[model samples]
Target: MLSQKDEWVVEELVPIREKVYQYLKNEILKGELKTGERLVERELADKLKISRTPIREALLRLESQGFVTTVPRKGVIVSQISLEQVLEVFSILSSLEVLAVQLATERLDEFMTKELDELIEETNRLLAGNEDEEISQFHIRINNFLYKAAKSPRLYEMLSDLVDYIRAFAHIGYEVPGRMREALHEHKDILQAMSERQIDKAMKMTQDHIENSRKAYIRTIDSVKKK
Candidate 1:
C-alpha cells in the first residue's frame, strides 16, 4: 500500500488516466515502488480511491515505458534496470550530446554563456557544501542549458526523453564516491572549450564527460549488487 503522502489527489485539469500514469511513473522513478514489487490493481484502486480501469490503464502505460512488467502470476511489478539498458542509454546520450555541444559551441550567445557560468559557480558551491542532491540537479540544468544553446527543438525533445529514461533506471552518476568533483572538473573543461568556440574540442570533451559518467553509474550499480 502507498503511504498517505504518496496518495494521488484528483486533479481537475488532467485526465484521470494520465494523472494516474504520471503518479505511478514518478513513484517508480523515486524508488518508492521498488523493483519487482507487485502492483495489484485492486490494491491501487482501493488506495487511490479511484476505479480499477484507470489503474489498469496507468500500469499498461508504465509497462510500455519499461517502468513495469506484467508477470503472469505477479501481475505488474516494477522493472529492474539492467546493465544493457544502462550502457545503451549512455551510448545514445554520448552521440546526441556531442552533437549538441558541437552545435552549441557555434551558437551560444553571451546570455547563455552567463547562465552556464552561473550554473558552474553554483555547482562549485554545492560541492563545497556537500549538497549531493542539489549538485545533481545543477548537472541537469547545465545539460539543459547546452541543449538550449544548441537551438534544436527535435534534438532537445529527444535528449529530454533519454534523460528522463536514464534517470528512471540508473542512479545519479555524481553519487559515486569522488565522481562529483571529477564531473565538475570535466564540466569546467567543456565550458572552457565552448567559451573559446572550439567546436571539436567541446564535442570531444562532452563525449569524455559522458563516458566517465557511464563508468561511475555502472560502478555504483555493481556495488549495490555486491551488497
Candidate 2:
C-alpha cells in the first residue's frame, strides 16, 4: 500500500536512525559535541552516509534526552551544560540515589553485599591508578548493581532517564582534579554504611557525596566560563 520511494525510505532509515542515535549519545557523553554547536541535519546525514529523515529522528531523540535542543524555525544545537543546571540535577539525583541505596541495603543478601565490596575494591584500585574511564565505569557499575538490588521497577525507570542526563555532563565533573579521589572515598563510606546496616547513614553519605560533586562541578564550570 506504500509507494516504492516511501518503502525504500523506511527500509533505509530505521537502522540508520538507531545507529545515529547511539553515535550521537556517545559523542555527547564524551564531550566531543561542544555546547552551542549547531547540528546540521544534512551534513550529519552525509557524514553518516544516510538520509535526512534518520538524522532528524536521532536529533529529536537526543533533544528529548537533554543532550541537544531545537529552536523553532532554526535548527538543533548542543545544550549548554551550566553549573546551575548541574546543581539542580545533582540535588534531585542525590535524593533518588540515596533512596535507591537505602532500599538496596535493606534488601540485598550476603552475596550482593560481597559483590558490592568487590566493586568498591576494584573502584579504589582504578582511582589509585588515575584511570578516569575505569573509575567512571565502576561508578556506573555500582549504581546499576544497587538499582537492580533495590527491586523497584518504577524507581529504576525514573533513575534510568536521570542517569542519561547525568552522563551527558559526566566528562565535565570527571576532569576536575581530586573529584575522582573524593568520589572513591565517598563510595567507600556509603558501602561501609550499607555493610553495617546503617540505612540512614548510608543515605546521608550518598547525599553528601552528590552535594560535594555538585559544588566541584559548579566551580569547574565557573572557571571554564571565565576563561
Candidate 3:
C-alpha cells in the first residue's frame, strides 16, 4: 500500500471538499481503503492537515454513493460490496458499454480510428511486457475514448459510476492465471470490430468482454473466500 500521508495532500486548484471526496473515493476504488475499514473523521482531518468539515462532507458524499455506510456503532466504514450488487452493476455496465461501442463505431472518424489503432498497439506492447498496471491504465484510456466517441454525457457518467463500484476487484481478476492475456485479446477483438465499422460485432464483443470480466471477478472472490 502507498503512504496515506502522501495520498492526503490536495492540489491547490480543486475545492478541498471535492478533492477530499475524490481522494477518498479513489482510495476506496483502489482497495487501499478496504471494505469495513473505519473512516475516522478526526483522524482523516489530522492526516489531511485540514479541518474536519471537509472530511465530514467527503464521508457524506461517499456514503451517498454507496462507497461507505454508517454503522450503528462503527460510525462510518467502507461499504462491503455484495455479489448481488456486483452482478447488478456489471449487468448495467455491460448493456451501457455495448451501446457506447455501437455509437462509437458509428461515429468514429479517421483520427479516432487512428487513435484506437495506436492504443491497440500500445496495449499489445504492454501485454508483451506483462505490465499489468500499464495494461490496465491503457484499457481505461481505450474505454474513455469509446465513451467520448459515444457523445453522451449522461451515459458516460452512469458507466463511470458502475465501473468505479467494481474497480477494486479488477486487479484481483488480473492475478488469475492467463486472465490478463485473455482480456487483452478480448479488447483487441472489440477494437478490431469497431475499427472495421462492424457495429453489431463491436457491441457483441463489448458485452462479452464485460461479462467475462464479471465472471473473472467472481471467480477471484470465490477463490479468496475458499482460502
Candidate with best TM-score: 3
State each model's CA lDDT, in order: 0.82, 0.79, 0.83
Alpha-carbon TM-score of each model against the true structure:
0.81, 0.82, 0.89
Clashes of each: 0, 0, 0
- What tens digits encode model 1's per-residue C-alpha lDDT throughout 81-185? 778987998999999999999888888888888876776677667767876667677777888888888999999988876776777777566578889778877
Cand. 3 TM to true fold? 0.89
Deviating ranges (above 4 Å) for candidate 2: 1-16, 225-227
- Candidate 3: tens digits of C-alpha lDDT, residues 17-84: 89888889989887789989999999988777788999999999888878899999879999977888
Worst 10 residues of 1 by lDDT: 1-10
Mind giving the per-residue lDDT tens digits that candidate 2 earns over 57-124? 88999888788988777678889766667667788888899899999999989888888788777766
List candidate 3 segments past 4 Å from native.
1-13, 169-171
Range of the 10 consecutive residues with the lowest summed lDDT in candidate 2: 1-10
Model 1: lDDT to the true structure? 0.82
